[model samples]
Target chain A: MVSTQARNALAALAATAGMAAFVAGCGTTSDGSDSASSGSGGCKAVSIAYLGAKTGDSANLGLNMVGGVKVAIDDYNKAHPDCKVTEKDFDSQGDPEKATPLATQIINDSSIVGVVGPGFSGESDATGKAFSEAGLVTISASATNPALTTNGWKTFHRVLGNDDTQAPADAKYITDTLKAKKVFVVDDASDYGKGLATGVKKSLGSLVGGTDEIQQKQTDFGPTVTKIKASGADTVFYGGYYAEAGLIAKQLRAAGYKGYFVSGDGSLDPGFVKAAGSTGAEDARLSCPCGPASADFTTKYKADNNGKEPGTYSAEAYDAAKVLLDGIAAGKTTRPDELAFVNSYDQPGLTKQIKFTPTGEVTDAVVYAYTVKDGKIGDATVIK
Target chain B: MQFFFDHFFELTITGLALGSIYALVALGYTMVYGVLQLINFAHSEVFMYGTFAVIWVFTAFGAGGHTSTGGIIGLLIVSVFAAMLVSGGIALLIERVAYRPLLKRNSPKLVALISAIGASFALSETMGLRDRITGFVGLDKPLADYVNGARDNSSLPVEITPKAVFKIGDYSVTTIDLLVIITALVMMVFLDRFVRRSRAGRGMRAVAQNPEAAALMGVNAVRVRQITFLLGGMMAGVAATLYMIRIGTTRFDAGFILGVKAFTAAVMGGIGNLRGALLGGLVLGVAENWGSAIIGTQWKDVVAFILLVVILLFRPTGLLGESLGRARA
Candidate 1:
């Protein structure tokens, strides 16, 4: 019995060793094959990728941008059938950790010549360096954190103006227009929200009454709302996406706060109005670098997307895609050639005359203040 | 100090309402741990599905913000029952599929725990991918529409509006707050009575003490465990509806943090003690609010966990220091 047991143990050990070796071998072989397959220079049908959340709390924003990019791709493909351009979508689910792996995958796939988005500020911050080192050209349509541009990523660009531009515009609207003396600043503690809140705080100065932080996906805002009530602030500036912004606005109103509710581009979606309810979102103001898409673009978007009106950043996404398609049309097909083309890119597109600075900042980006009136986001008026 | 005094009544009222939710969810964790000595990590998913059930029922009836007071009451009852049935069903399914197999094989405690975690993830991701799953099955459009979408924060149209019911000092109490608190108290009283006096409750205690010994007493351990899960899940379902009424929104992962807090409450109250769960939850809720009022809102969770650690250091078995098997009603 003892001898048989010893023989079985030896067999088990050998089997375990063999399995571990097999798994390790598989990993190395896959990596070698992946590298071997890429880096071929030939006339291949190049594609641009849309990297953002297509399903989640922020799905509306990402899906809308994808819609806009698809329009640009359709127009480009229709114009140039031989030099065919296609779009591949990568869903990050609005998570930064997910974006990192997807970014690495995008970098490995050499067929993807350029990218239209990583849509959110958090995802952009997470994947910026990987794309930069890989020399992959990425033009973000929505990410507005000013710190993103400061990362010194040569391949990164954005069509929207940064928070530094829009925060002051929001502060001016709150202080000069509404003339609110005491303002309470709140953020969801996300990278995007905190940066914008800090910018608003700097612009507001002494008018800022206090600052508070909340987590994303927080449903109850009673304690924060009560604190806001006690602070006796006449204006409440929230720096977060539409999900929490709507709840905060609704709860603040319920807690008897009747003041100007102001936020940045993150709160510029129609879902914000739906979340806040018509009564809660009455007279709420949102400042964004992206103005309303022109009537023609809106019509085209509606036609393409089954009559679903485009939400935040759809126009800018179209413009970003146009920048790449224009470059490809002008004989810039390779990654290096596309990067150089976008670096010195200048053209009139849907949103505005698109031009990138050396640091990838839009040359003439403008901020617009939008008001919620009668349960609808009103027409955008230039903040200045 | 001034902030504390001025908002004392309002803070207390809010704390009580929030505490009631924690208490309902805590009962589930405590009871499950009592019978199986396993923390049902997937209890949060049970609560989450309860929330969806509430939404589905309301939507099916075409209820909206404009529903009348009587209509709201009727809808609330229907939705609460629907939530309870759905959550209880899901809880039984989880036990049969995730835990029973491990228990039958006499697996190590650590393996059962890992299984619980896996089950938790599976349920949450399934809900998150509801749309894709429905689309793949080629369900009819209207049915698919109901099952799909809303992976993010979805708010139910306000069926019950908060109207001032009465005033306490300078603070006004709303009808919704009163309703939630009263409903929670009623459920707690009924559960307490049922556990102390019922025959099945005695079977649960016997099994919790020793499954083999309980088998010798002719008590069906398997049936007793299922009943315990059903009871816990029903309480969680009630809590889910109250949470929706109070917060007015639900998300796929909404139950995660709340579940952690509820489990912490159960541990604080002495895991497996029913009455202790209620006391622990109320204390946690009030303490967190008052702490936030004193310090800052951002430090509320920090203060709660700190209090727990300090309490554990003193009384490791928790405040009441008695499991369900040994405790009186």
Candidate 2:
């Protein structure tokens, strides 16, 4: 065994070494981020970047998206071994505070020809301006806010439907189809949620009886539900993810608001059913881009994913990666520069023949609506 | 006004529940700080480890995914016990490995602080690095099938997917929320009593106040410090299990931001005081929820940090003073 004196000396050395390492760590002033935004390679392979919450609250969805992209890249790499597609991943964690800097970092990367996502609408909104100005193409799978379409980001593309298509579809079904006049609209109050809610409310102007704006991550929806119940609203449309939406639906049903409950694509998940439970969420109608468990993609997705549950945007993520590869194929970029190469990405792909207008929205798109029946999402119905 | 009241009740309950989790974590921070007077910056990693520990044990014992009332009591006992042991061991190791040498050399507070921060970073990085290995080993479980069942019966309404709702007049409480809140409160009360009434607790307070005096009084200050670390570790483990039940899953790096929130709660509650940590956690949780209600969800973290700054600027002593029974630890 080592003597006490030797142990003491080793401890002193470790303490000194740790202090030195910390001092080096705090020396981040030298712009010493190890995630070198720009690699030295000048296009041996096409680089597509993804910026989203790979490691935060929305990490679950982020992981699914990354998986879809990785799958796409694997497929693409196999198809054309010569035209290899490389990918760079960054985790903004759904925070706009980090999104701006991440955008700059991604933009600085000389190899990245296009971007698959910035995930949440807030992060997209924050990064869109800079990305557009820098002439980078960004396609989002999950971001459904209407604001993103009109934000004047020419380089942006959405693989799936946006709130513009989704909100009105929801309003039409809930108000006109479901034959409900008295309605309460609740938003998660994020850019996506509030925007979607606003879109639905605008469409259902006379039909919407009342509205409530609840912030995302608020665990209890009792007050919002109570207000809806008191308003005599026969239906409620929540514009948020499953976390808050599940709890809200549970409380509304439990509080005896037996009316219809519907939410935008954000609330599309088995987690909602699990969290809200069966009784409260029995008749709940959840609107999403018709892809979760539908026969079209779910059959293949389930097989490929090893029976893993398809999250809300997994299909869209798959489509986003496909579009990026398509863009690379369309250009036939043996060694084309990123800035020049990505500009020509406004073309057709396997998913939906993606072509972005000056505003960066797909020229033509449709929204899919699904109802949460017994906690499992039913076959999605497309609204053309 | 009706809307205000309608929103108030739910927001308050949510805040209290979320805050309790924060409080559990904050207790660890305060306890560690009390003995060492050096921030246990890595306490969040301990919380994260505890979360994984619960997940690991549940998966191993074949009792994974959504704790039922029947299985919950047993799961809680095992998970809590396992987490406490793991966290306690981790905390002691961290102290012995990272902090003990600095104390022996009488290193500058700045040096110790830097070392603590490094240790925190190291732990966080290690947790994230574990993901790479775990992914390779293919531990990815299809949670939907086991957790959510099937979707075939479109017309038939199965019990709400997680059909365990506890109704209290207007409130529709779930078993998950109820357990989270009760466990947090019970833990806090127990810790308060132990620190206030027990001989060991008194010894801890003495050590916190003046290590030299406690040493002179034959307190075995080193052992006391280790015990406090153990307590902090145990508390972190409990907090992690509660957190997972709320969020439904645990990731490798889940504890970093949570640890920050817990630390903020501890500081908000007044760093050395146990009750302050408790109150601070509740306040932060409520404030974040209410802030989300008023502002937007995007600004939730912003609001939380702003509240911390305002609290620090206005009343550094927090909601409670800087002590459990006596003054500043």
The TM-score measured for candidate 1 stands at 0.85
User: What C-alpha RMSD separates each model from the true structure?
Assistant: 9.1, 11.7
Model 2, A234-254: lDDT tens digits are 888888777678778876776
lDDT of 1 by residue, A1-384 (tens): 001222233233333333443354345445534543563444355678888766554566778899999889888878975556667777766567666777776787777789987777777888899999999999999887677888889899998787788888888888878899999999987767887898899999999998889877777677788788888999999998888898888878876788899998878877787678777787999888986878888888898899988777888999999899888898887899999999898888777778988889998878888999977888787776
Clashes of 1: 0
Candidate 1 segments whose C-alpha is farther than 4 A from its true place: A1-60, A73-138, A147-156, A323-348, A374-378
lDDT (tens digit, per residue) of candidate 2 on B159-188: 222235765545556666677889999998
How high is the CA lDDT of each candidate model?
0.81, 0.69
**Candidate 1: what lDDT?**
0.81
The runs of at least 3 residues in candidate 2 whose Cα sits more than 4 Å from the true structure, single-residue gaps closed, are A1-163, A206-234, A242-259, A269-284, A289-364, B2-16, B64-68, B135-182, B197-199, B243-270, B279-316, B324-329
Q: Per-model i-RMS in Å?
A: 1.9, 8.0
